[model samples]
Target: MKLARLGVLIDEAAMKRLHSYGLNVFERYIEEILEHAGAPFETITDIRALDDRGFDIVIASVVPENEETAERLWQYAEHGGTLIAYGGLGLLARRLGCRQRPRTGAGYARLPEFRSVPAPLRCLSAQPWHAEDAGAGAIGALHASSPQGELVGPALQTFAVGRGAIHRWAVDIPTTVVQLQQGTRPVLHDGIPAPDGTADIDEGILKADDDIELDWEWDREKTATGMPYFAYPHADYWREALMAHLVRCALAKDRTLPLLDYWPEGTGHVALISFDSDFNEDERAVVTLDVLKKLQIPSTWCMIEPGYSPQVYERVLAEGHELALHYNALEKENGIWSLEEFTRQRQWVQSATGLARVVSNKNHYTRYEGWGELFRWCEANGIAADQTRGPTKRGNVGFLFGTCHPYFPIAWCDEGNRRYDVLEIGFLTQDLNHPNLSDTTVIEPFLKQVAKVGGVAHFLFHQIHIHRLEPVRQAIREVVGKARQMGFAFWTSKQINDWQRARRTMRVTGIDAAGQVRLERGTVNEPVAVWLPTSEAPESIQSPGIVYRYGVPCIKQVHHLTREEAEC
Candidate 1:
């Protein structure tokens, strides 16, 4: 097989120093890796007149400067090509005119080692959108917040175009000394191979205890200021990133990337909690039950058919918890049910729950593949709210999906309203990931968030998931105690739905003097500190919630049967 060919494009700032904010040191590293990649490679500071006849993918990177310039680079991708960039997301999406801002600090990077998470986009981190020029099959890996305090994984994402591929990365560049690569791009090979790309060395650094050596060369070129790399070792790390991104462009795969799930703007704020069996699988449910029992907090549980160990379901129903059907076929993980199967399962659970009027439903694993048909079936049969989504599977699949809160929405986007409305309850972190999260930290981070906008925290704890951990009950007890202390109140799915009437009324009535723009629900003036919806600033705001979209100061309620005042 023949080797691949690539062209490197960078601004003038990258050429002077081999390792600076732009491309200095990266050029040397790029040369080494391309040579090692067993392919013809070329580098140019000017993108104007490059002969594009023989290259594969384009690599782009982010800096404290030149952000706007990055936008112009999309032409390369739009013209049936591929690209990679050194930028973080959430903020990245917002920056690219996605029209929405990040809320609270949702897209944060927490690397304890760095004492850093993508901190409020002062310079290091940013909210950017994917290049729309690239096709929708783009694979995106974002900065995941982990316990290491605040570290972003060297992540990578890719997409396909007409006869080409586009790749983007938040990665660590390669270098001659340590032979390292960091950022979000994937590593293809390891070592400072021979001129023809053969190897014999420990190249890159993976996270601790996971010895995955990096692949490629660590080429260091001299600069006048000697600050070729940015600050600290990060210079070398970024250099490695530039190389890895280019390499991915050279050897990307041919497959489809999953689309993220997002709620449409008009969807209201809602919460969905199912009262079902612990099956004893989830580690937190039992303790959660204990907590709810003590707090006397009412909740709705979607009882799973046949899976609900009869006795538990009876007790849950007797406890007066609202019962709804949680549907799933006989086979668990690999099961794919048809519309009939879904309908049958729902009816079976409804009968077993003994609720002659089982009017609500949520799906197990939140996977209702044919939701459109299922929701339609629900509407025809009197289901009120379809509450089957949250911090599902992996929480990163966030984008635009269509429902916001518990709303009477036109069910599926394309098919129009099918009668059954799907409500989107915001998500809370799963205990499995943050087992150390006592009831204290769980509510601490979310309090200021709720106090400001009144969104639901939606924490999940199964009896089993919680029982596996020590002092589980205390964690539950603390959460209940804190709710009382915070002066905030709780609302079940049904109650919150009922309250939207008053809330919406208050919202529109309190419309600010601005007199223009629309107002969304959860708008409050109760000493609220928001993650301002503009790229203005984030240095000060005691409140810690992150907002990904802007607000127009309308009160949090709906007035008459009509949309209110317009811009003057």
Candidate 2:
């Protein structure tokens, strides 16, 4: 089956509105969602090309330029192509049997059951619509508190049209994605000051052996930042829905488009064990390394250049562990770090480790402001991956951007939009964020979520803290033990980075009607998992790599080096 060619109508005016507010609104998020779903699409800016005969389906935000373009959209929908319009496009709404009501201020809505689970839908501002007529049905609903009190209405509606269909969404999906991507959340009035007398708006800190209590405040109106409110807890839900809807639309037009497998080689889940060399204590570092050695697990040590010594660097390399940089500001004021200083640190680490280039890094304190410049530095310096997207403190913990998967970070600038070459391997769980460092059970919930999604379970452990705090050590041990028992493949950060980079480069050049798939290009000498959307299992498998799973097609490329040649 050939891939469906999706046409996305770009609304210049709507894009301008987002850019005016320093947001990289639409394209990147849409591309990411589509790519993850294995859906191929192209952008159409000219309204003259909005013909029903041109594309299998056309998607446009409610903010169309003029009446002419809007009319063209109607014709496109009425003639014979699936039209998906978001927000309150009057013509599209009426055609979809939906009537738009008054605006419901920014709030969160409970999505209808997706994959048998009710996910939360967070919107800055939502326009409620309902399917009141036949030949149409509500797919999802938005639940919000309004002036008339609590109300529920269709957030997504579908209607059958002449030889085609119209899918309308009341919630602003692009805006939500942009907000989550930027980590922009409205300031909640429930503010608490840090011990240093600074305002700690969204940060929480937990000590070792402390009580485990989870509190999520959902008062929509109480925000200090004056920004529109968004639901952070289920950001991934909204993203998943956006992708699912795109796939559904494509399938409706043509069902031959194959769904991409999430993990490489159809592995259920992946685990990454990493340590932040924040403290320069060699003994503490040795203790942590000793534990990992006993478990026979290879971990990535993100070493601080200033805190690192020749002895420790040699020891880590000799033990068959991965070495990465923990880039930190040499002289810091207000958490800001200079690019030149970062380069100096990188050179220092390279000189000490005797490696010409480093592939991975995590910012000290995760203070990643001036990200555009920071990422530019990474690309220029040959850094391939980063883990700085994790929460800096306890308060801001939990899935930021709602995904545990790695993606190319979008760089939003006044000049234009660009995606960096570096991969952002996000940290899903961290030991310091919890109040009870000794409590290993806190991490199980995160592990469970990742397993449920077949996502990466990346853990962050600080060497100094783990050595000083026995509970932290215990917690790490328990989490690792449970994850092993659950069948997670433990990998170093570099290994995961290599696999993801290869996966992104890989392409399914062709698939025939008989379901025979062909890969034209991919990472050479690297293992990859190819997903085939067929009930009948695959036969006549051909590859040099070992097949971990036959049906789903998890293949490890034949390694040229001997066991002694490769790091153990």
Candidate 3:
């Protein structure tokens, strides 16, 4: 099946603002979506270039400013090209069969096609819109509900233009998504309300929980104790919705796009279980290691300063587990929160364990301050992954950052808006045994949601609790069993970091006229999955399985060989 050529038009000026203290998200969010979807796309800065290149699908993320660019896009779509655009397209809106009305300051929007309820959507323009008539040819795919439960107008409208079509999102999706992921910059020092009673205000450190962007009353479902049990994954859901539309449009043109699977060998889902070794509890570490051995699951042990004896570290490595640094930034005793302190701790752990490199780290108290600083420190230190952006309080337990997948965070401080080299694999909740915080109740639902998105379900536990508290020990065992039963393979953080970074290097050059997928792969040591949408399963496949790509059936095949072997 010939795949449609995909291109994202960039607004140069808007992109420039994204790096600065401006609200425009531009192509950053779009780049994130395509990266997660594993779709091969090019970034187009010039509008006229769309003509000669003949892109089958163009994402008009950059709303045309002048008449010439707008006319070019209109002509391209009229001549049979799918154009997916966000926000307003100015005068071109009426020409494409959409009508705009007075904008409203609403907080939410819903895409009924995804069976979605109203999720938090912050308009970068500070105004959420409801389309007027959208004309007769336009169909509303997403809409915002009124106070009395009426669908007043559409946020996303589709219009059939000549031989092609245009899907327009009336709201600013890029800024909303980036906000959902990174949260507001210069986080308020006052901190969000901690009604669940987990906030330790005396710490004087701006913890990760301090910057909770998800609304406690609106974005989460509560438990009996008024703590959050279910956090609606608005970011992930929106991403999936966008990808679904892209796949649908591609299929309409008799094209099938190849998507990269999240896990190796067509695994249904993936999970990561980690332990924070607080105060270097060697005895507690032993008990936890024993449990891991019994379950045959490899885990990541985030070792703090003056970590366990050499024997314990050796045992962790011998058991095929990962030894990662657990940086101490809490105010216990001389716990500093700076790059220099982070480096000192990292070096201490390396010297203590006699290890050459430490690939991952997580803060002691989930201690986070400011935005992008920690990421920059990790980048400088060669830390490939960090698991610090998660809930430290009960009220904001699940998907607080609105993602379960490991992603490279963008350095908002950078003038170029470059993504940090570090990957953030945020955990759902820490210490299920912690009273009023989390328990086994969150396990099934959390894992289910992660599996739904084919993302990594990461859980954190403390060695002290795992050994001293029987309930915590039991909780870990039960979660492991359930995860395995649900087709989730438990992997170390290093493994996940390695896999995601490796997969990012594999490029889909294109799909040929003969229906063959051309690939450009980096040095891959483990299996990477590439899914091709097909009407029927191929007769010959290397470790093939049946899967769905944005609701379309596809045959998933794993690539395990090197570039040379693949060519042969």
Candidate 4:
């Protein structure tokens, strides 16, 4: 459907409570979810200024201070508007036909449809208030204990209004928002001793076992039915579930529009074969490059140091592969780098490669502390994108933000909730993470998931690992073959970054009363894919650089044009 106009009511008093509770109070995570879902929204602090005609859906987290505010919200819903109220908003519950009781002890919940993999949600300390009304339908079932306990009540609910509806999430939405936005869990201990037991690898460099394995389980039935399985409790699945609910609410109000797809040209999925050049051996790097060349895959090579073999860089460029910076600082003390160091190192690579700019990078050792500053540094230094959003620990591999697609990160620490200029390409799978690299099966499930969602299949491989370990090479080869078989379009990191940048700025300017669609080109010249939800496919289509593909739904793409015209 057409992008839904959303409005979030900000309650100052609710902010105070959330802050006093030591939970994250920002709405940036919600905005990020909307942006990725292609739903445009605005924030409203003054309840009087809210216009039901303006927003198709309105979300509020605080209880109304007086009867007037509650009456206004009730009137809006009565006029066929969607209202989503988070817990702690007792007035909203009564208006939506539910009775909110006193808060209960900490517990867990089972959200089956909320995620591909249904994980038991452990609502520590801030257990949701129990609902006492029979009209409230359960969205999630609560457990009495932490991990697994006896059934208690509904953790989330929905109730019907006059001509609209209200979705009440019993648990704390802000807490989940904060956890998803920060992307990093609390550092439990001083350090994790390496397998060899020589010394600890600093706390932030790798995630603790508890953080990685958060009691998440795969849904066997869903898997058997060929549904995508995203690891639950991971930020991505939660974000996905939240957005899906929001979209469902919007669609319930109106269902005559089309939803946006992540990729262009209606491609099933995109693949990036990346290699981190962290070692000192030029021969090893060359060997890995040879393997890629033989596979006919255009990969991205992230160089760790400045002075790599000139021949290697030259060959990479000549073979149509991309050269990117792998910003390296092996020592724990150097987690955050100075802007001067960033500029100098990036410049050195640019000078050697003879390219005007180097847009892609992955931090050495995956040192991701000070990410907000690092991304700002990337923008300042003209770096267009980064792939350092992966989990710090090697053994744990999954989406940190619950997506395999590239997105502009909402500046977590920035005021005014601004977004970063640099695009974040989520890491899909890595070579060094697995105990045995020969087990090509480690990535099969993930690849299948990405393909199911038509997401980006980003694969990170260390050149040294591939050169030293035969299994690593075999694994890469097998994965590459599998992706090709699955109909994934192979791309360099820069290509993915460029396409995402263009898509982010692209917009639908208008649809005339006569049903003609108007468009505006984004900042880039890349082709844009326009997905139109239609009941029946057009017999034939006519437009420059535009192609129509029919499936359960169909999408139209208009490419290489500053301006174009189309009819649905």
Candidate number of the best TM-score: 3
* Superposed model 1: Cα runs more than 4 Å off: 1-274, 278-290, 307-314, 329-335, 392-404, 407-420, 432-442, 466-468, 501-568
Q: lDDT of model 1 at residue 154?
A: 24
- Weakest 10 consecutive residues of candidate 4 by summed lDDT: 213-222
For each candidate, the alpha-carbon lDDT, in order, equals 0.38, 0.61, 0.74, 0.62
Ranking of all candidate structures by their lDDT, best first: 3, 4, 2, 1
Error of 3 at 365 (Å): 1.1
Q: List model 3 lDDT by residue over 1-568, tens digit each.
A: 7877888987676456444564435345688778867888898876768887788899988544678878888888899998887765766766754446655543556554543333444332322243445353333333333222334456566777788887777666665666677776745464756555544433466777676556555666765544465466776776776776677677778877788877666566899999999867789989998988999999998988778999998999999999999988877667887899999998998998888999999998877777788888898888999999787766568887878888877756343666778888989988886664677777887888898877789999998898888888888988898998999998899999988888788788887675557777765556777878764444544434766666666766566776676676
| Candidate 4 per-residue C-alpha lDDT over 42-139 given as tens digits, one digit per residue, 9 for 90 to 100 | 77766776753477788874434677877888777777777886565566665555555656665566677654434665453343545566766787
Q: How would you order the candidates by TM-score, starting with the best?
A: 3, 2, 4, 1
- Candidate 3 wrongly placed segments (more than 4 Å): 11-14, 17-26, 97-106, 114-152, 194-204, 222-227, 512-514, 525-527, 534-546, 557-568
- Pitting candidate 2 against candidate 3, the one with the higher lDDT is 3
| Over 4 Å off, model 2 | 1-3, 11-24, 61-64, 88-99, 130-135, 145-149, 185-215, 218-233, 330-336, 370-373, 392-396, 413-415, 432-438, 524-568
Evaluate candidate 1 by giving its C-alpha RMSD to the native, one decimal: 19.4
Model 3, C-alpha of 30: deviation from truth (Å):
1.3
Output the lDDT of residue 452, model 2: 60
| lDDT for residue 442 in candidate 4, whole number 0-100 | 44
